[model samples]
Target chain A: MSGTESPAVAVRRGRPRDAARDRALLAATLAVLAESGYGGLTTAAVAARAGVSTATLYRRWSSKEALVLAASAAFAADLEQRPDTGTLEGDLRILLRDKAAGLTGESGRLMRALIGEAAHNVALAEALTAALIDPVRDRVAEAVRRAVARGEIAPLPDVDLVADLVIGPMVSRFLLTAHPSDTQDTQDARGTADRLLPFVLRAVGGQDASGDGGFA
Target chain B: MSGTESPAVAVRRGRPRDAARDRALLAATLAVLAESGYGGLTTAAVAARAGVSTATLYRRWSSKEALVLAASAAFAADLEQRPDTGTLEGDLRILLRDKAAGLTGESGRLMRALIGEAAHNVALAEALTAALIDPVRDRVAEAVRRAVARGEIAPLPDVDLVADLVIGPMVSRFLLTAHPSDTQDTQDARGTADRLLPFVLRAVGGQDASGDGGFA
Candidate 1:
């Protein structure tokens, strides 16, 4: 769901002015969301932040939910890039490292805000799956496909399960566990990736090319 | 922390009438939290729901955060009972299955509300680690210890990492992914546990005693 194909943009075709305005609005939405959270956010506040009229905001998105969903989708699209590091372990390290880094900053705040809102909002929950979880799932599948093609491991029966096994620990550590902000450093991410690599490789039935000989 | 050790209850020790009131207040807090989420909950509302005055609520819990944390801790203590099925896989299956079931009900709602609030509140986050995550980690460690004692597996280097590997996927599925409520059935929990057991065994350097081999 890119800008060009979005219904809001399609309805206002040939208007580069509105496209720029849309970006400002989305950015403003994210900013407001990060600061005030989903419950505290309002269309009027978003409009005020974007220097637009409430009428203009309403014309673009029907409700607060729609605006938040659109903003989240736009934001997630920007973070959807995945690396191809040849080996599965290499690919996972870069991807998870980036994820760890992301979870320590604004992206993390945005996620927590959205997740909090999504708990009571079914439509928002679906939007989150489409915007965030779906993209991650696609990236994991691609990584697994490359590994299989390169003969790193045999074809897996369930790539989704493999994805969960690979990505779950990082998510758990960042989201479910409590840690001081100072401790969430790049070195921590690298060490976590290093420790998890052998277990991941073993789970996927691939040999640990790192020669770490599994956890001691 | 249990009710007896809680400062709120400790101050009012030897008052049996207040102990029952405290339970009612904590239960009311959870009920309100489930319905209104962390953002929508108020000390006044919780007091009203428990048929108590704002003064009484303040006397017991100084603020909304304190009230929510107490309620959450008490609620979590009820769900902390772990199973012992002899084998590591067996114990995990039962535990994860119970977790899956819990995620579909009021416990899930409570957790989501807490997590949503935790993203913004460091105190809440730490409280959650103490109230929820720590207990689960303890249970996982106990299970691993039992397995080691039984010769089902060698000692692990990091039981916390092992715990993450085992529990993270299920949490990711229920919390992060969007699914229709009707589909969150017991069979699904069983199937998920079945699929994850092999990977968990492999990750912890234990043999898959269930004879399922690995993921097909």
Candidate 2:
């Protein structure tokens, strides 16, 4: 999948598909996801909302899961990008703060719904593990490797385990709290990141390299 | 809320409810939850499965959310009970292993569904926080207190933060991996606990107290 090619391009051959129409359908999916959640979302409703026939929607995406995956991927892709901030601590803080910010908007709504649906839908669950979770894990792993290479932190036993250590608390808090996308919850999540940062650094033996700041 | 009283008891006066019947209903609810998940669950379906009328189910529990919460709480209660293992490490290892064990079978299915449904249902979210999340957190906090008192670890920072650090990775891993409940995954999760334990001890300056062992 090239950056320019939409997910729909693979299914359709030479037929000229309207990019605007695809955007409309995906936007409708997001709206339906936010308004009614994944269980309540239907392709017919999305077609109606997007001012298109069900055929048009299906021609691009085969199932509701596919459409939702495509839409969620658009948002998660932005978060999957690796950050370069000279230091691992700086990069992590920025990544976490940006993540908290992302969880307070339309993208966050889609994510919350996707996560909910993934619990019951095996296909969606697998897709989520591959598309969203793996990417973030890979990005974090890359960051850790860079940190180790720069002598910012000592290498440890398992990179994946350490990556999980860094992101685990924030993800757990977010899932349990079920906070809506709002400024207050976003700030609260950021506060949680601040507290966890020190421990995460200490877990990896990055105390001196992290510039020696209190967890407060 | 008393040990002698069922949750259904206080809601209705001297109606002569059968505790056996309540157990059957909750069991049916779990069956439905495992088969249909929370979104597909209905009071009517639960009533049918329990061989009772909708009115009978409603008489004891006002809503589907309430019934599910009560059912989930029944299982979560078992997990909330404090384990006295003579040492913090022993307590933590047992707790983590037991928790991993619990995240399997019928209870795990219900938990996955409730967590999914709770994303959209505020009442379920709050009830989960109060019933399941809070109790486990409190138990951990109590464990930390005991450890500190026994001089196993010196406490300076927040207990809740430390608690989160301990449980967060496990929760996050479970959510992300969506691994099936088998001996392999259970063993893997326990291995994760073993790795995280020392870091947790180290985080609280318990490296010397934790009886040093290599993370490898």
Candidate 3:
């Protein structure tokens, strides 16, 4: 996913960093991003918001693109905290529900803008695909692997394809009608989980249809 | 989806419109849209592009939103012309393949931009959902109906939901990696159909696992 990976990254060693300052800057960056968009984001604005000097901001990240990517990386790391309900069905249900919650309100707007902007901006696009898409996809793969280990699903030729199958419907519908107030707004994450789980369950070859095997 | 619907529209009688002129205008609107984005589109530009007067443009569409909606309607109408390969599987393979073709190159850029812009612009979002989203969804529903009529599939509990299920994976994957030059660019529609068709067929309960029924 990181198509623009530099040789320096592989060989670079970490320097002692201020954890609290980094958190503050990232938080300020996310706030600005949520309010404006990627196009409107500036390192100066982020520094002002964080009460840090521009030089300090530049010390950690090179540019607005670099800062946004770091914030996205932090965001993605949070998304990797998956629910373990002892069954694939339950785990997926909770996972999808959590995803739904994230895709609403301000956070949803930020995500939509980031994904949309990725189409035009190559650097941001590659970074997002690397930090956001790949890790979360791997997390889903790990969940499926657990399901396979537990005999909840078959030993399929392609586990990643199955992950896409499970996530596609909810996300597709979500992206189409994610507005705050619309007549055909079907952004209800809980309800989406309810309607879509059966098909996913069946697709994975899960034996328990009764919602007992982690569905509830 | 048509949030702009009014009782007047239902009661009003149609004024005769020139079919060829309407086509030209819509074609021009799409051309300009593909070249530029929604933010860059203007009525004067569309009129000039179509070789029609600004008066003529306004005579048909009162505003830029109206013109874009009309063009979207034209796009949706073209999507409705799905190939009939004598079986649901064949029809869907062709259908998805055709969709994939549309999503590549210039047309793909237009589509991606439209979807992304819809998140910020409510009017465009509503018009697109009404003109583009609903009509194409109806087309999928029609395919399902035809399959049912041929006894190739069962009567679905909810045809629209099933349509979303069929389309979600392809569109989701398409939207994520839509750029022309990206390392993770998996925009091959034929390959997408090959991987995705089995799931769609299984979901709809098609008889022929072999591509002979309509897939080829």
TM-score to native of every candidate shown: 0.83, 0.83, 0.78
Q: Which ten residues in a row have the lowest lDDT in candidate 2 chain B?
A: B207-216
lDDT of 1: 0.77
Q: Which digits, one per residue and each the tens of the lDDT, describe model 1 over residues B1-216?
A: 243366655667647867899999999999999888898999989999999888778877889999998998998887878778878888887777766766666677777777777866789999988987777788889998998899887776656787777767777787776763334775676688677777777777777764655745
lDDT of 2 by residue, A86-203 (tens): 8888777766666555555565666678778877777787777776677767767877788889988767666677666766666656666645543236777677777676676666
Residues A86-204, model 1: lDDT tens digits = 88888776666666665655666677778767766789989998987777778888988898899887776666877777667777787776763334665676577677777777777
C-alpha positional error of residue A89 in candidate 2 after TM-score superposition, expressed in Å: 1.7
DockQ winner: 1
For candidate 3, what is the DockQ? Answer: 0.26
Query: How good is model 3 by TM-score?
Result: 0.78
Alpha carbon lDDT at A12, candidate 3: 57
- Model 2: per-residue Cα lDDT over B1-216, one tens digit each: 343666566557544455767888998988898788887899999999899888778877889888998988776775666878778777776666665555554556666788788878778888888877777677778877888889876664556776666666776677655554332265666677777776665565455234433333
- Report lDDT per candidate: 0.77, 0.71, 0.68
lDDT of 3 by residue, B76-106 (tens): 7776675677788787777667656556656
Runs in model 2 lying further than 4 Å from the true structure: A1-17, A44-54, A178-184, A208-216, B1-17, B42-55, B151-154, B178-185, B208-216
For candidate 2, what is the recovered fraction of reference interface contacts? Answer: 0.42
Docking quality (DockQ) of candidate 2:
0.46
Distance from true position, residue A197, model 2, in Å? 0.3
